[model samples]
Target: MSKISTAILRGVSGAFIANSGVGKIGMPAEYSAGVQQAAASGIPALAKLPSDKFGTWLGYAETGLGAALLAPFVPSRIAGAGLAAFGGGLLSMYFRNPENTEADGIRPSQEGMSLAKDVFMLAIGLALMTQGDDK
Candidate 1:
């Protein structure tokens, strides 16, 4: 790959990692809800030991993994794979929730756009995973 391409890849990877880290931490409610749901649906006895504890751990894991991906020394491909997997899980959850309609306070058009963005970002992450750090 060209020097410029590598630079662009690195910049994109860094930005994505950092931004995702912040989102994961800032949006603890989202992850917490997932954990709670998983626990309620017979996820695992250990995981459901304490709902609040599980939620906190899930939040920490999300933020920590995201930050690790942002570190300069980390391999871009691994980071991308992690983020891609996370995005896929999120996408699946969002789609699975039948109650997530505009009637639930989420504007249908905006939700569609957000879903598109998530899918696009997931594609970018998968592309990065397949392509490695450089073009």
Candidate 2:
């Protein structure tokens, strides 16, 4: 059986991420374009895709990742890997934009506060990955 702590972490984060993904799947064109533009600023390759495609693909990715995390049959390490990758991507976006950071560069500017909070997901993912099964 999974530990209670692990279950709670997976349940909460999975639900939140999945819900966010569902919302993005049906996002309006202007909103998709705006989000795509922001992401492109961090990873230039993202700019190559049309905004609608990017949003749909991102939504599917998030939904799949959330499902993986929520599935008890799935191994924690595997789910954690996905979460870690997602968190890393979000952090990259946060770090790559000069406008997102304060003068010190490490600290988050007002615009970056939301992105900076994604670090918790990275931490949780690492924790899940390293933890042994409860037995």
Which candidate achieves the best TM-score against the true structure?
2
- Candidate 1 residues 1-135, lDDT tens each? 453654465466556655555554434565666666743433334344554455665556666655655565666677667768766765664555544435553443454445535665477567667773442
Cα lDDT of candidate 2 equals: 0.86
* Model 1 clashing residue pairs (backbone): none
Please state the error at residue 80 of candidate 2 in Å.
Answer: 0.4
Q: Model 2 has how many clashing residue pairs? A: 0
Considering summed lDDT, which 10 consecutive residues are worst modelled in model 1?
39-48
lDDT of 1 at 42: 32
Compose the digit string of candidate 2's lDDT tens values, residues 1-135.
Answer: 359989988888888888888778877778888889988877889888888677877888899989989999988888988898889889999999988899999999999999999998998888788889734
The clash number for model 1 is: 0
TM-score of each: 0.58, 0.92
Q: Which candidate's lDDT is highest?
A: 2
lDDT of 1: 0.57
Model 2: clashing residue pairs?
A: none
